[model samples]
Target: MSKALRRTFVAATSLLALLAGASPALPTQGTFLAPIAEHHHDSSLMYGTSSNWSGYAATGGKFTSVSAEWVQPTVTCTKTDTWSAFWIGLDGDGSRTVEQIGTEADCSGGTPVYGSWYEMYPAYPAYFNNAVHPGDHFTASVTTTGNGVFNLTLRNVTRNWSRSIAKSLKSATLASAEVIAEAPSSSTGVLPLADFGTVGFTNAKVNGKSLGASNPSVIDMATKDGVTKATTSGITDGTAFSVTWKHS
Candidate 1:
């Protein structure tokens, strides 16, 4: 096999080995990054609301690929630490695992912090070493061969940098695909959401078709007490939409 293909094969096999005996949260650079999904999500509410996620997710069918592009929103910070993420993935809408990658805007100790990360859910996210500032244009995608091998790719167009990881998840359900703006969680529960104003996403696609073609569910972030946090705009032209933040 050629060198590049050999590398991909090795990466895929290595991922299977990791997942076969995965830990709750793996240490990265001797530190654990918090997980992002709400484990107890009520998927029964397909077009329902979530406490931490706002965007579009298409379920009820097997998905092989998902992609979207967005401009990273800048966070307005306060004394409270808060976190927000924007991403595209193939699961975790109705299943346990999510293979996703995206950009992050956070308020760390009341200061603005920006970066990017990818997570194979059930494991802590592995952060990319590159810095991603606000306004960076990012295009990301997750694709699987419908058997196991998967590819996750992200590009910071404004920064002229890209990353692609070949991974394997033999037990992945591929239950759903989505592009989301989320309030990331810690060991406790959903953390405080950063004030990101708004993020615009375009060129959304699922399995090579426009995501709107799947009749995706539009989500709004809210609390069980009926407090709205962020809202998703209906997809326009089958490819574009926006999420506007409304709370902390």
Candidate 2:
């Protein structure tokens, strides 16, 4: 298979696992941090009305799984002048839930990057969050662990874009990145539980012959599940999750 095809396959398979409530174990080679809540002051900047949530399962004090994916679009003026952007959200509603706090960005002069995370909270209504920033070339992941109201964690990854731009591009790079919510945070924030809801993505792409114009889809709660597992797909490749929560 071609490189693009391979990437699509891998991304799709990974997203499937997340939606099924079955997440793989973390890598032991790389150092990892315990899950923590990362809150953002700018919540309204990413808010919208057309958002939906999915992948709800029950986990009693044990670790439940969630994941997201999406594709991002890159604008190329010259082979040497190019840029891209993508975003996603992490949220939940209840007395305590998981929330996304921040993200990291990575990129290449010509290629893309990846990002991921694992978040944890002590209360419900975590709020909508993203794993990456706009105009970045990166991919991300998230995970969480804990019991009832305590002992939750979050992990994140953000791909950074390069400053160099290829001059005289042969083809336009328009695509959707994948965003996954591997683990929900356990928090007491009001945003996670509000009626407004949350959103995420999996992939986005543009044809070499056509202009790319697509917006990232939102993920929100359809049914209230007590500590349920959910998944979001169809996002810009390399984008992560961000957050904007309201206190009610």
The alpha-carbon RMSD values of the candidates against the true structure, listed in the order shown, are 10.9, 19.3
Error of 2 at 7 (Å): 36
Question: Where is model 1 more than 4 Å wrong at Cα?
Answer: 1-35, 38-46
- Could you give candidate 2's per-residue lDDT for residues 43-75 as a string of tens digits? 212221211222111111122222333333222
What's the true lDDT of residue 81 in model 1? 74
Candidate 1 lDDT tens digits, 57-117: 8888899999999998988988887878899998886677778988777776777767677
Instruction: List per-prediction Cα lDDT, in the order shown.
Output: 0.76, 0.24
Best by TM-score: 1
Q: All candidates' TM-scores?
A: 0.84, 0.24
